[model samples]
Target: MGTPQTVLHVDDDPEMLALSTATFHQFDDISLLTATTAIDALDIVSSHSVDCVVSDSLMLPDGVPLIEALRRENKDVPIVLFTAKDWTEVADVASAAAVSEYVQKAGPDDLSTVLEHVGMLVDGDRDESLAAGVSAVTEALADHADAASAASFSLDENWELVGQWVGDDELGIVVVEAIEAHAGLPAIEEPLYDYIDADALEELLRPVLEDEERPGIEVRFPYGDFELAVTSTGDIFARPEPGETLY
Candidate 1:
């Protein structure tokens, strides 16, 4: 079997802890570690080789201090601030900007969203081909998407592509349509999060997203094969490379 992805979920409330357990229990590849407090979570993470951490924002010790404590202890695990509090009020994300993801409490599929971000951050490292620069997204996605409705954002006609943001659309659904329409022969089977860390992408776009007028922003990561960008208004963008497509 491949190596398992271990997640440490921390929350003070018993019910909250129960909900998180119920949420991630179905993933066969995930080894979930539950903690009721930041202190306990820290003790667990310090010893274990954990892949990711999901913590509530307003716990007894609070997430920011916990994050600070982890960094002080040199625990570099990616942290997702899962909270019932508004994203705006979450000072850690805006002030620290180190948390991997700060997700709002609203939305029908909140747990799924957390899982999506977790998966994006966990399975994020991959080799991508950066040969293409900017090219128009072909008619492939546009054609199939007519059945769905108008996209939240527009693509450059002559554009270098990586990946497109699905927005409210199913991430899996948008990725399939994008690959079927764009790639020359072999298709993109994995979701876009597999290409780049969505939490990182979110961190980049959060500042602009905070401004109502900004609507969207572009971000690029130099280390990867393709430059990565995300629009807070909606959707995700990544430069598509031939060799980078995962089976």
Candidate 2:
């Protein structure tokens, strides 16, 4: 067996810490360490080998500050903000801080989501090839803003699609095509009826993209093993979802 992974969970609430400790006890391969303050968390990190850090957004120093400090100490250790805060509330700051994952805490079941991200991240299961493909697409979009009406890009072995966009059809084609490619079957052959409601997703995203009031807004969602992001400016990005084991 591999060396047991260590996770440091930071929260000011003693009860929450105790609950996390109890929850982690069921996993023999994981060791949980708790701290009530950012100082203590940093101290523990410096003294021990930590595979991942899970933190509450609202604490004495706040999650973003703690993340900054953690980055200074160790740039690559996975940091997950397991918070009750809405994604829109902390999205910009958290992204700037280079957070590995953001797991919203809505109820008891959310703890399992946190555990999944920690396990996947610590195991180094992220798809680097997929990330590279997404980066290349993003760069192409920036460089050729006025040149092309449509473009096609090939992903790694996992997925491929002819990415195209024009006028108000900002995200429709790319989102559907990407999801279909990821599923490895065309929509007609094996429709993801129960899995993803493509039309509904486009409707929800329409206002978000059309709203000039919120210019920098970006919408993100999980489709199969990939997390897809679409910006207001009609840019599409795809990366391996954090908690999934990408084959």
Which structure among the candidates has the greatest TM-score? 2
Model 2, position 176: C-alpha lDDT score: 67
Candidate 1 on 112-191: residue-level lDDT in tens?
56776787777753101111100111121222223112332354542344334423344445434544544443454455
> What do the candidate models score in CA lDDT, each in turn?
0.53, 0.60
| Model 2 error, position 153 (Å) | 58
Return the TM-score for each candidate structure. Answer: 0.46, 0.48
Q: Count the clashes in each prediction.
A: 16, 0
User: For model 2, how does the per-residue alpha-carbon lDDT over 75-127 read when each residue is reduced to its tens digit?
Assistant: 88999998888999879768866899998977545665676677678775432
Best by lDDT: 2
